[model samples]
Target: MRKALILSSVLLPAITAAGIAAAGSEEKPDVQTIVSKANLVAYYQGNDGKAKVNMVITDKSGNKRQREFIILRKDVKDGGDQNYFVYFHQPADVRRMTYMVNKHAQLDKDDDRWLYMPALDLVKRIAAGDKRTSFVGSDFLYEDVSGRSLEEDTHELTETTDQLYIVKNVPKKPDTVEFNYFTVAIDRKTFVPMKMEFFDKQDKLYRVIESKKVEKIQDFYTVVKSEVRDLKKESKTEMEFGNVQYNINLGDDLFTERYLRRPPREAIR
Candidate 1:
């Protein structure tokens, strides 16, 4: 369940599921060789962590924009219900946020999500239909942001380059996903994901994720620098993290619906 557990997507359609196992075929390809590319998957582990993100958006025609956020993670149990907190913050403005609190006893399915809006002072539930859409208007899908079974994606090993497998991702389900498909580079020796390129519904490369730094924490080595590149545009998303601690105590009070609607707000000076 350690490595394999990360490969399944509970609600994702078979074709676009995030973490499915690759089929075994002699002439076809070896997906396992490709799925482990670039040591990207290895960074997903840990119970507590945080990252400061810089997102840049650029169009294929060479236009760009930049934004920032702080991502915090911790596991907590409230009133006998166990859950994890994935929090985001933009220090300068309260008007902008993609903040959500996800409560799940199970990994893939059975999760409750709440988002706080500064404009309405309301915490609303994200519609199920909208979960597949991109979060914060970024290239990464919402499913990729919140949580999905990592092993549900199926892979096709294209070839080995730089001692890693160039894998093409084929969703198990045909039309259930937002993005087209993924082409990731998996490390040959370490089973890590090095680079991930995503295509659109038209099967054109639009986004690419590249790993920058690797660190060991809580028995799992995590990606310290992750850059999400938008090929169609002139911008990218850079996620950087340090002091990557895991399994630290996160108070249950922080994961409640009340907190989601009205998290601590600094007093206006």
Candidate 2:
């Protein structure tokens, strides 16, 4: 979700410095601070970035489908508002389809999302209720493409181990989401969320998002591969990132509705 990989050009050094400063410190950061840092590390990387992603969707019967897309993201402010543009590039049927999001940080404001279906020649506004629905028939939800706001959940530091800080998050408005609650296991050193487990109303674990691989790019620790599994359905989506670059100075104009229909050259390339 949200690229599934964390690649930072501008913020890595700061994170490293903070990590060095906290070395051997017995007192751990509060739950809010830990969650905030994890959020920033996961979603708010460089000022702007780009990644080419290949998604493999597999059903319970073991049939598989693949989709290829390029994602472009620009941060309005670190740990605040952001913009996302995704252009599908493969599998003929979905080629040229695009999705855009104007993500607002305010708790009272909802993110604006749009989907462009080239075959139908329609640009449709995605309803807030649909954010949790399957994304392009994949296990990942639409909300996974951008991110869910930290303010929407109340967090508690449930456990701390030598390597991770475990936090349990409960939705502030339970009715708005499908999961009863979720717990995130964040790496202590990098603050990257290593795994997230989502439990259903019956308190049974039904979904899981986990980081599969991490790499250092441009001196930044980044997650390069991940998977989302629907345990109940025995289906899963595996995503791999390639050709990722950060701080590319992407312009705001590239994310506008105009480009959704006629994708910019940068997006297609």
Candidate 3:
């Protein structure tokens, strides 16, 4: 199944399960306005940012594998175009692997991505195909790491609570996406999506992502911990972010293919 980016935790509580149907009489903002605010809150915190990531992938048997990396991001425009550099640091076998992505906000445009492997000493340009493919063998997808464009889907304000706004999203090109529709619960005050559910064409809930924790860093409400659970596979991926800094001075050269093959020591360190 295709995954949503800037997403949530793997397994949520029973409260949220029932809360999906809950509604309130509180006055609410328009769907477009709420979605625009959520997009900015989730992805456009600053012109540039840096973070250390720790990802734990668990299979149905409960076996766990860990991977660590550092990500550097720079936005050419507040919410239009962005550049990302991801450097893998852990897992002795995959150490020094790097990836670069150029994400465009326009739905008509496709993102550019490249991957480099130290072991093979080869740089491969990742072709655009299935954004739903597992990211480095984890439950997360390529779109999850880079992000999905807001314009790709149409949004509707389905329900509202005192603290949250439940929004339903239907992809503009339904045939290109695996999900029939998805629901996101956006925090009223912070505009962060606290929970998301993806439904298949059959209307069965097969995947859920939720934010478990959020903390303010550099005055930005950030999701520090989150997870993605595959209900059918009975597997999940838990991810944590640390050492997050916003508005850092990241030069444009850092997002080049040269950096993907020969990563800058300073940025990764």
- TM-score for each prediction? 0.65, 0.87, 0.87
> Which runs of model 1 end up more than 4 angstroms from their true locations?
1-43, 58-66, 74-88, 95-98, 103-111, 118-120, 147-152, 178-180, 200-203, 217-219, 261-269
lDDT of 1 by residue, 34-141 (tens): 343222344334445555556555545555545566555554421112344444444356444445555343435555666677677777786545456665666655
Whichever of 1 and 2 has more lDDT, that candidate is 2
Candidate 1, residue 59: CA error in Å? 5.2
Best by TM-score: 2
Minimum summed lDDT over a 10-residue window in model 2 is located at 1-10
Please provide, for model 3 over 211-250, each residue's C-alpha lDDT reduced to its tens digit, 9 standing for 90 to 100: 9999999999999999999998999999999999998888
How displaced is residue 113 in candidate 3, in Å? 1.5
lDDT of 2 by residue, 1-269 (tens): 22221234245557656876888455566787788778877887778888999999999999999999999999987777899998988778888899888988777777888999988989999876557889779999977767778778899999999999999999999998999999999999888899999999999999999999988776566788999999999999999989888889998888887888888787777
125: Cα error in model 1, Å: 2.0
Total clashes in model 3, counting residue pairs 3 or more apart in sequence or in different chains = 5
Q: What's the true lDDT of residue 172 in model 1? A: 72
